[model samples]
Target: MKAFIVYCHPSENSFTRHIRDAFIQGVTDAGHECVISDLYRMDFQADMTEAEYLRDAHYRTTPDVAADVRAEQEKINASDAIVFIYPVFWSEAPAKLVGWFDRVWSYGFAYGDRTMKTLNKGLILCSAGNPIDYLEETGILDSMKKVMLGDRLTGRVKQAEFVVFDSTSRENPLREENWDKNLKAVYEKGKSLFAAK
Candidate 1:
């Protein structure tokens, strides 16, 4: 199966990057083709502008910018699964990643009428300040569920997995080994799900 991996982390040596890399490697080792969109590395713009919307509405898709948007949309359209790997800043996604959602997942591209209904899967791999239970108590996970699975992915993605790291560690918890464990768990789950009926 084809998996589109969207990673949003600024530092090259960040713990977030380490987790993302581990997930990518695991998915690749599982014999799946991976399309990676590294948001920070790409210098994506998080803010949405009315001007860009107008241009898109007019189909004034320039060769460079237009194709870039189309390229990401096409990848989403073709993928069987999507993996979102990023650090949870203030209990939400990084700014540029949010911008990615605003720009890349445009109307008639990421979603539309009943004409385009395809069941796919989405996996959210994120790191936060606390454990899943704590986050749930604070209603963080629910908000993300609505935003990630509800607003953005919608009916296009049926199955959704949330892999969260309890990062209240005194030091960096996203060490290579720890990140590998998380990725391995997610990868195994994916394999099992894929193998099922």
Candidate 2:
């Protein structure tokens, strides 16, 4: 199986970066292919031009999508699974990633007589500064999942999963303590990505 990993992070020296690497390694070790779109490293343009806005906001369904957005759509069509790796910011993905959805998920492609292929899986791996309990207690976790799985990924993939590695704030002792465990868990996720349940 082929996996398209959309990794969005500004810094290389981050736990999220390590998660991306480890997940790729596990996938490759299991003999699955991997392709990555490192948003920050690639300097992907997240902002939509006026033309784009006019097309999408009006549900124009035009084929005149930007080259970058078209390229991202092609990647989605070519892969069996889509993996999103990032750190949770303000209870959501980074602005760039959010913009990716805004632009790449175009009218003619992701919806409205869509040409986008339904993938085998869509998985999200995000790190959080606060504890998981805190996020859950505040209903932030459910909200995030509803947006990602219920909205963005629904009907786009055959199956989906959302995971959070919480208590990752630099000052939180759990960051160091759970580092290895989290990485291993994500690695396992990669290894088992296409395995029969």
Candidate 3:
């Protein structure tokens, strides 16, 4: 089985990057092929142009998608599973990821007689500034799940998951304390990416 990871982060010196590295290592160790799209490193064009907006808004399927968008879609079709790794920003994924959806999930491919394949799983690994309990209490957790799993990844993936590594703010001591533990768990998660469901 193959896994495709979409990693988004502006800085290399980040816990999120650590999560990504550990997860990738685990996947490779499990003997499954892995492909990574580091959005920031690639300087991916996240914003939708006027032509793209017009094509999507009107639900037109004839126009050809941009090369970059086609490349992402190709990756999705090639993999058995998909993973998204990033940090939570304003109770949501970074804007780059959001825009990825806007452009990549085009009408012809993601909807309206799409060619994208149905994957075995979809997983989200995100770091948060606040604690998980606080996020749950504030309803941020559920909202994030609904948007990511219920909406964005819905129908596209056979299974979907949203994971949050909370209390990762620089000021929080738990960031350091839980760092190893969280990475261990996510690495295991990666190892099982192709395990029987």
Q: Write the per-residue lDDT of candidate 2 for residues 1-197, one digit (tens) a residue.
A: 99999999999999999999989988998999999999999999989899899999899976499888888999999999999999999999999999999999999899999999999999999999999999999999999999999999999999999999999999999999999999999999999999998
List the lowest-lDDT window of 10 residues for candidate 2.
Answer: 61-70
Error of 2 at 149 (Å): 0.3
Q: Higher TM-score: candidate 1 or 2?
A: 2
User: Each candidate's root-mean-square deviation in Å?
Assistant: 3.7, 0.7, 0.7
Ranking by lDDT, best first?
Answer: 2, 3, 1
lDDT of each: 0.71, 0.95, 0.93
lDDT of 1 by residue, 77-155 (tens): 7788888988888778888888888777665555442223363788888877666787899898889777887777676
Using TM-score as the yardstick, the better of models 1 and 3 is: 3
Where does the lowest 10-residue lDDT sum fall in candidate 1?
Answer: 110-119
How far off is model 2, as Cα RMSD? 0.7
Steric clash pairs (candidate 1): none
The positional error of residue 95 in candidate 2, measured at the CA in angstroms, is 0.0
Candidate 3 residue lDDT tens string, 33-89: 899999999999999999999999999985899999999999999999999999999
By lDDT, the best candidate is 2
